[model samples]
Target: MKVLVTVKRVPDPETTIRVKSDGSGIETDNIKYVINPFDEIALEEALRIKEKLGAGEVVLVSIGDSVVTEQLRTGLAMGADRAILVGCDQDLDSLAVARILAKIVEDEGPQLVLMGKQAIDDDANQAGQMLAALLGWPQATFASEVVLSDDQQAVKVTREVDGGLETIGFALPGIITSDLRLNEPRYASLPGIMKARKKEIKEVAAADLDADMSPRLTINSLEPPTQKEAGKKVETVEELIGLLHDEAKVI
Candidate 1:
């Protein structure tokens, strides 16, 4: 079984984000980058599946420029067999990203594809579903648990929905978007880090994929949220109620 996992480069959750002065985007300078947390969980799940089967490959794929190689190498150190970096410097929206990934999927023909339900930076949870639609494959999103059949022909995924948990089954050659609860990612061991230095990271220019690179959506501007006003102290519950009704307008 070959599992293809999509990895995304995102700002570290702990890092403080500063919007660019021109309102174009966030300032990238002096910011730390890491694999999207949800994508890391997906990669971990792929590694665990390979380890359990004792015979399989876990491949990582990301779309970005040379800078993304750092995150790819980190994933390699986490036990992925190899990586493919689709080189593109321009920002791509979810649909363009999905088209590129679909092209790669066609070329690789992996039995399963795993990726995060959403990227932290944009929070646009559309890629996985769009990719699935492009490939006409079954998809399970927000997956908290995934089980593969002995024959490796089918899979069962338990996912989180608005109401509660939902379990669904699908055959191989499908897509699963992992959620936060899927699994905790492991750190790269010293030996693994050393080995990653030798692992192959193949780069393919995005233009060669023949997928439409045009972005359907555009970011006009980015700005930080306005700071909230400080709270006021009240003498009693009556005062609080009055304030809520008159000032906050909740009552």
Candidate 2:
């Protein structure tokens, strides 16, 4: 079972985001960066699967610039065998990003592709699905649990939907996007960190993929949202009702 995990370098969730002056995208300068939290769980799941089988390789793949190596190293530290970096400068939509990953899948020829449900920055939950479509393979999104089935040719996946859980049996050579409940990501020990530097990180350029990297949509401009006016304090239920009926026009 050769597992390929797709991870991302996302801005730290705690960082204050500011849209770029030209409105093309968000300003990334000086912001702290980290591996996408959900991708960490996906990596964890991949490691667990490989550990259980006691065989196969866990390959981490990401599409980004030089800084993304640190994020990929996080997966290597957690037990991935190796990594592939598709160096894409600027930003890419989920569609273009998935295309690059699909190329890596062809190069690596992994039996499974694991990734986070969505990256925290864009919240575009489309990469895995797009990759599956691009590869013409089956996909299971929002998978909370995954168990190998009877013959190791299939996987029993339990996914979380609105209000409940759903199960599906998918064949191997598929993609799965993991949710938060999957597992807690392990921290890289000092030794693991040192060893990660030695692990192989194969980098490739976007132009080499023979794909155009153009945005289909253009952003006009971006500005801070208008501040909301403070409402009058209501001391009693009657006052609240009055305010709702008149000032807020709720009633």
Candidates in order, TM-scores: namely: 0.95, 0.89
- Per-residue lDDT tens digits for candidate 2, residues 144-247, read 99998756798988999999999998789899999999788888888888888899999889889976567764557777666799867768999899988988
Query: What tens-digit string does per-residue lDDT give for candidate 1 at 39-103?
Result: 99999999999999999999999999999999999999999999999999998999999999999
Candidate 2 lDDT for residue 104: 83
Instruction: State each candidate's clash count.
Output: 0, 0
Best-matching candidate per TM-score: 1
Please report, as a residue range, the 10-residue window in candidate 1 with the lowest summed lDDT: 213-222
**C-alpha root-mean-square deviation, candidate 2:** 2.2
| Model 1 TM-score, all chains together | 0.95
Name the lDDT of candidate 2. 0.88
Q: What lDDT does candidate 2 reach at residue 65?
A: 86
| Model 2 misplacement above 4 A | 212-214, 228-232, 241-251
